[model samples]
Target chain A: MLCFINGEIKNINEGSIGLKDLALQRGYGVFDYARTFNRKLFHFEDHLERFRRSAKELRLDLNYTNAQITENAETLLKGSDLKNPALRLILTGGYIYSPSGNFNPNFIMIAEELPTYPEENYTHGVKLLTYEYQRELPHVKSINYLNDIRLDPLRREKNVFDILYYFQNGITECPRNNFFVFINDVLITPKDFLLHGVTRKVVLEMANKYWKVEERKLELAELNSADEAFITSTTKSIMPVTVIDDKKIGNGTVGMKTQKLIKLFNDYVLQFSR
Target chain B: MLCFINGEIKNINEGSIGLKDLALQRGYGVFDYARTFNRKLFHFEDHLERFRRSAKELRLDLNYTNAQITENAETLLKGSDLKNPALRLILTGGYIYSPSGNFNPNFIMIAEELPTYPEENYTHGVKLLTYEYQRELPHVKSINYLNDIRLDPLRREKNVFDILYYFQNGITECPRNNFFVFINDVLITPKDFLLHGVTRKVVLEMANKYWKVEERKLELAELNSADEAFITSTTKSIMPVTVIDDKKIGNGTVGMKTQKLIKLFNDYVLQFSR
Candidate 1:
């Protein structure tokens, strides 16, 4: 895997900070990410749109317009080697101030090969223990992944794939992926309680054409008895969750409904590669 | 300002990232910052302490240790020809994993100079409003700050310096700084509910010697009637807030208690440069 940090390919050994920098000192920074297929990015516009929105919310001086970012990204990809890679942009809160007033903004970019993913798990099906917590920000992806990381050690030790973070009230999501439930004939997904995933948007598009999709604040009553359940993300695509907490999701198998939606989404995304 | 990206003093204009880059796409990145006073860094060890904690929490791999980071940052600073710059170090969660599961940790570092303080903000003191939201990772400083940016437009339009976040029962710190209250001879500050600021720590050190210092959870009631109120961070050492939510802070002229602490802190830090 190769990484271009501030426009350079370098050894990971020499590219890091001392313990005391301010971003670490106070958690002051903003970032965004998107991946590519066959070395070509899909929905680059959408990713950047969210990125710009994130920067604005965090007060990061990205100093690049969407068009300019698109141009640069396209040019950079023209010379890359990997068949598939993931990219991320980072902007730090200006260097350490007296921890005082107006401070200079610090910026950097790291372009690297796509990080690892559990490809097999998506296909074979995964179990989700109902996690006990509320999604802090159901609307945005911020860098504070502590909640996610907190469970990593426990999950690894237990050999589980992921956890379904549902509100005690039965609302689900606010985890690594957005969630949906297919009950009877309706494709019901948690809305307003999860990040409006880019992939979720595409899934909605697929559902609009072939299924009765409904976006509503979901409740536990609806999910527990649902005929099917699934999760969506840039990498996960549309994978079925065989179980949530301990209850079997639609006979503990990838429901036919989920597979169809995945097929539709994959086909739509591949159109970009062509 | 001088910036050392992978130990090079390159102009920021020369820096750019490929769109398909992993850092940009995954948001797998980390960074740290410190300040220079009379051409030297202050509390450098403390910054590194937090930096390491953040990296550990995020599972980011640094190419080097504390000594090496310091050396690289210094070399970059000297090479870039900047003095009294707010020094920086940024590291991205490198493209360590191939999209197909192959692994290569690609990470990089950049050290640069930025303003330590904005004269206008420090001298005149700007208006401040409470942000409805707070930092995502109340602990580790990951490179995610969109919430701050999203609230900025509303803040700037409303003529506020920074938003002070108050949860259901208590007052959190400013979106950018730790909040403090000075009453008669007792120094009351928000504890556990805000970022444990290095500047706030310094304030505590001084208060221990000059006044009564209480480090515990502070109620909103304590802030409203305080004799003096100020904010602290790595940059804004100690800034008096004359007004909050349309109310005055003490006499609102940088109370003697607040002023004394700021002076004491500066006098303690200036020793590093000499």
Candidate 2:
């Protein structure tokens, strides 16, 4: 696979970062991932906007403009032969010490095959484990998934898809996805302490036309009364969450409303791809 | 300078990790740093123990044993001519997808010139700004310093040495050091929700002989009544903190007790190096 590293396109194996790069030294970097459909980048502008925001929040000197990054990503996607390429853009704090104050940021873009989950995860709904934790700097899409990746073994042992993080009795989000629940015929999601996912934004816009949408602080206790629940991400789109911590959500099956939203999101993606 | 990567020793510039390595990809890595005194590693066993704990906390498979890592560090230090070298040991989660579960961990040891702070910082004592934040997995020394690095501009603008993190009115720690304060002539530091630094452990042991040491939750409001304050780390050792958020600590000078502790720690280091 071809990857873009500091203005050069090369093989992914040859795309190595120096040990001094803060991305490795201090994990001081921000990244955003988006997927392509039929060789077309899906919601590239929104992803780019978030990427720029994340970089600015970290004070990373993202020298390249959005247009330049988009062009480079296009070049990378065109150079790759993957059916559905997933583009990961990383902006790192540069390799200089603080006193000198000269930071030359390293920008990296990797084109890889879009990872696919089990089809049953979307068809019959997936299960998630509940974890009582909150991410630091929740708004920025920084490359800090230490807590999330550390639970891989427990997640594998429990046979769950992902972990749902809740803090102080309030539900927040998953590691890589934004969570939504339907309660008493109202579509709702947590309003704060999570990355504002692009797919979640699209789902809100689409669902507002068909159902009542409420974005507010969602309580963990409210999940028991939820009529339906699902998660949204660029990779998964809309995956129904039928179980949380072995507890059944809406009869432990994919709810009708979740299926409808999935269809709507799929239609929107198809239109955007065209 | 030479660095130890996996099992081979190579030049520092040639030590590069693949883009897929989770240290860069997901910030899934842990590291511990130790410095040498008189060309001898100071308190190396304690640092290695903490490093192992951190790696286990992150579930990073550190393939090398402590003895093996120590031998490698000695080799790197012997190969380099730099006096008082700083050794940074990083254990990454490796470059492989999780499903197949074949994680070939990458252990990297980089030897560099020991970073030096301004001499006046120690003499006149340093100032720190207080920020209402808490680190995730505070016990694990993971490669997640995004928040700390992001505050570089603010710290430079305010001309403070570092940021003191407090959570819900309780003092936690500094970004890379352990915080301690002397309140009413009693030495105290936060007990929980922070990395247990090796220097902190040694300081507590030594302080017990001189002053009444209390390891409990230190409140942020207690700083106002603090007679003295200081931070401990591998690099800074026992540097005094005379001001926090522009508030004067005691008479805004390095306290007599801090100076005494500093002398004691230096003497201990001298003995260890011999």
User: In candidate 1, which residue ranges exceed 4 Å CA deviation?
Assistant: A1-124, A132-155, A167-176, A198-213, A220-222, A259-274, B6-22, B77-80, B98-126, B270-272
lDDT of 2 by residue, A75-184 (tens): 99999888889899998886875742756789999998998989999888999999999898889999998888877887889999999999999999999899999998
True contacts kept of each: 0.08, 0.78
Model 2 regions lying over 4 Å from their true place? A97-102, B99-102
In model 1, state the lDDT of residue A200: 83
Each candidate: chain B TM-score = 0.87, 0.97
The candidate maximizing DockQ is 2
How well does each candidate superpose onto the true structure, as a TM-score? Answer: 0.74, 0.96
RMSD of each: 6.2, 1.8
lDDT of 2 by residue, B1-274 (tens): 8899989999999999999998898998899998889888888999998898998887667888888988999999999879779899998888975743756678999998998888888889999999999898899999998888778888889999999999999999999999999988799999999999989999999999999999999988899899999999989899999989988999999999999999999899888888
Q: Is the docking of candidate 1 incorrect, acceptable, medium or high quality?
A: incorrect
